[model samples]
Target: MANVNEPTTNYVILTPEGVLHGFSQVEPSEQQLALQAMLAPEQTMTAHEWVERYSEIWLDMFIEEGWVEVVDKAIIAPHVQLDDFLRYVSASLSGSRRVAIGSDEGFCLAKMGFTQQEADTLCVAAADFFDFLKRQQQRGWAVHGHAISFFSTIDMLMPNTSFIFLWINNQGYWIIIEDEPLLNNRAFVELVWGIKATGERFNLLAEQVLDKKAQLESDQQAQAEEQKK
Candidate 1:
């Protein structure tokens, strides 16, 4: 099996020699069992069994050593300004919590937020980063910042801009903001932590906001009809 640290779109891998896939009890059902049996005819291990083995191997080999994790989030709302982005970045970095910057762009950047000095260091690094993007341009790659723009380099670029780039730190988490928002609001952030704290699960936070927006639209239409009457 491939390492757990690396997630791939295709959970199953078929080689002429053998078929490989991970299994876990998190999805314990007869349907899952039948699928597993079909996939691995020899061992016919249950999904839960496979997952347990996979997780055990991961813990033994690649358990993240410490204080940083970059998680992905959904992009379901308008983007924020560059100023607001920096503020959130500042707060995340000042604390020891694991911070992540996700985007609707497709990938997310996860890692421990950096301090002012570290951010400054990244600014210096951005020069080189920009240069790298320039080279990749010939192949259809371009460098963009937080906001949408025809320009290739980022300078006072708008926040919540759409583009793909890798954000790295000394930790295991990294972000590749491609099509999602890097969440940094207090209420939302707290909601995320709250979910994490209670081991509760939910889909992307922005989706909830979108749902509320839809409700508001429906309500407004009803009010308009009453006013006409």
Candidate 2:
């Protein structure tokens, strides 16, 4: 991987989008810079391979006590690792209705409506005990609601380490302590969404799916009315 301070030897051609010209090229941001440094060369990985490798690293970092299954189909951009994940959390999802937390050692993204103290408390809890997380995971408790976002530790230079993400949503709170967070966001959102959008991954397809479902329901209703006629 290239040093963060070193410029490329040549102006390797890139698209108008200004994405990097190297393997696993993403947007040219600090997160991408860090990611390019930390990750295995993209030439050596397929998309699926990236996901699997990320999950493995995450498990090693966070699975102190319980079993964790990375929901691959549920994530948007699964290629993202730790640094990219934190950039998303700190810059993107910080103030949104949902909360997200990310670090190089481990990353956590959660939706939130909790007070700052509550949020801080959750962070403390995650930082303090590995067994507590395990019990909650085994009980199948929801971590996404109104609880809090938590990040136990932050270590920039470490590899294959651990972190925690607490995501709060309308439904509940969710805690993900993995080696990395699946940091996904929209191009427009990353540039314009501001601080609150930082930590969690976003899915453009989720919105599309919701629209499609609504259209299907409308079509069904129309068909039913025609049958009555």
Candidate 3:
């Protein structure tokens, strides 16, 4: 017998397409409260029985009141090149004033509507913020292992503008938008997948280049040794 008066937990559901939907519990109605009271001490009533009984009183009400509805997914085509992906993401986030992608090392890879200096500065700030967040997580302040996204007000950029920072696959994504309604999960999913894919692709390329360079160095050293022999 759990306390029915306790606050219900909030739920976040992520669809396959990368859209995130949040559901919050509504306040219990008089009838629902009465039903909870009646069932409070009823040890014989199974969990299923309680749920079934409550559904009869509240399910129809929720449906009639339009409490739930489907959200259409934003279709984003897959992009192989990082430039193409960033361009597409910028267009999709039409409400945003500026968007930038950068590495964990504080180097801006691509940006829209931001000077190179500004973007680089922002990327460095984001890297510092991410390091702070990781330290907090290590200190037991954050229950999750890592932070996915966060919002902040950036006075450095604009007085009333909002900054959204997303951490995906060791890449930092910055979105600057007006202080209105923030970007929804539908568009968010695209950035998540896009960043992940491009990050992995470039990382692989970097690894290959490093491997080739190491091989060349090894061969040059071997040649010098043979000449001495």
Cα lDDT of model 2 by residue, 143-208, tens digit: 322222334447443222223322111111223222332233332122211211222234445777
Tell me the spans in candidate 3 whose CA falls farther than 4 Å from its real position. 1-77, 94-96, 143-167, 170-182, 200-229
2 against 3, candidate with superior TM-score: 3
Which candidate comes out best when scored by TM-score? 3
Candidate 1 lDDT over residue span 1-229, tens digit each: 7798994332221111111111122233443232223233222233245445454343222213211112232222213433344344534333333233332232232323444454344334434444455476657854333223123446634332222232211111122122233333433333222222222112345578899999999999999999999
Give the alpha-carbon lDDT of every model. Answer: 0.33, 0.33, 0.48
TM-score for all predictions?
0.26, 0.23, 0.45
Ranking by TM-score: 3, 1, 2
lDDT of 3: 0.48
